[model samples]
Target: MIHLERVNGDTIWDILKLTVADHQKNFVAGNDVSIIEAYIAITSNGYAFPFGIFEDDTPVGFVMIGYDKDEYWKDAPAIADGNYNLWRLMIDKAHQNKGYGRQAVELALRFIRSKHHFPLTM
Candidate 1:
């Protein structure tokens, strides 16, 4: 089963070691870079929340949730206070193509729902 864990010091190294395939390298930024960006965004504006994807306690991927009112939504009044973004989602090259990505997204959406900023219909 796929699960999410806070990306603390213990799991940071494992997440940093994850990478995409050579042919897909240009499509996604390295986890190391993403983590750094997440950290900066988190500390500066309290928006990004980074997590490590785990399967049976083994780190398999990384995902981050970013909430920004101005930067993301162009200041939409309805969602002005809360604009949730699935900022990043990545599975290691070794873990790709195994349905993990879909599961990870499911887990992320579930997590976001639990936070419950506004009503979600349909």
Candidate 2:
């Protein structure tokens, strides 16, 4: 099973470690304390909402979905006009294609819907 929940101050560490570790392995851009710190900084703000994706009890990946651009990293894309950005739609290598990414995306969408953030699905 897959699920997504908000990454508040309490849940940031696990997601940070998992995400940075994956980035260290898969991303040519590299991952480090500084990068993870940057993610933490954004999550501390109101403009971004980060979610942890889990398979059963273990974290599989994380996604930060929101509209603000100033909080993103230099490499991250700016959200389109009137559209929210779905950043870091990642599933761990061990869990990829088990449909977890879709589930996580759906959960994020549903949660967004509850907030009345998006009037139309894109």
Candidate 3:
């Protein structure tokens, strides 16, 4: 029962406390840093969105996905418009290896599909 919820004041405290294991710390940036970057993007006219991964009523992980249209597409032409970058996905150490990551990704893909942002081809 994994679902994503927008990061709001009610969930910010729990989100801020989420973390990875000490050994895997170098693998990804901390959630706090990621959230800050998301906020900056939100305020800077970028398409950054942060979400908290939940299992039932518990917050077990976090994911941020969006694209900076002005900056990201400038350097790379492969990514088409309406495409979103999966910026960050982190599942806390306490609840890892339980298929949550895969479920989260599936949900994200479904979300993108639902947006119908891709340009139709003739």
Worst lDDT 10-window in candidate 3: 113-122
- Tell me the lDDT of candidate 1: 0.79
Please list all clashing residue pairs in model 3, or write none if there are none. Answer: none
lDDT of each: 0.79, 0.61, 0.80
Q: For each of the candidates, give the backbone clash count.
A: 0, 0, 0
Error of 1 at 88 (Å): 0.9
Q: Which ten residues in a row have the lowest lDDT in candidate 2?
A: 28-37
Q: In what order do the candidates fall by lDDT, top score first?
A: 3, 1, 2
TM-score, one value per model: 0.82, 0.62, 0.84
- Candidate 2 lDDT by residue in tens digits, 1-122: 77786666776676666643454565522223434544664575524566778777788877767554444445644344445666556665666767887888888887666665533233
Runs in model 2 lying further than 4 Å from the true structure: 19-46, 71-79, 117-122
Taking the tens digit of each residue's C-alpha lDDT, what string does model 3 give over 31-105?
A: 889888787766665677788999988999999887635342355456735568888999999999999999999
Which of the two candidates, 1 or 2, achieves a greater lDDT against the reference?
1
Residue lDDT tens for model 1, 36-61? 87877656654677889999888899
| Candidate scoring better on lDDT of 1 and 3 | 3
Error of 3 at 44 (Å): 1.7
The number of the candidate with the highest TM-score is 3
Best first by TM-score, ranked: 3, 1, 2
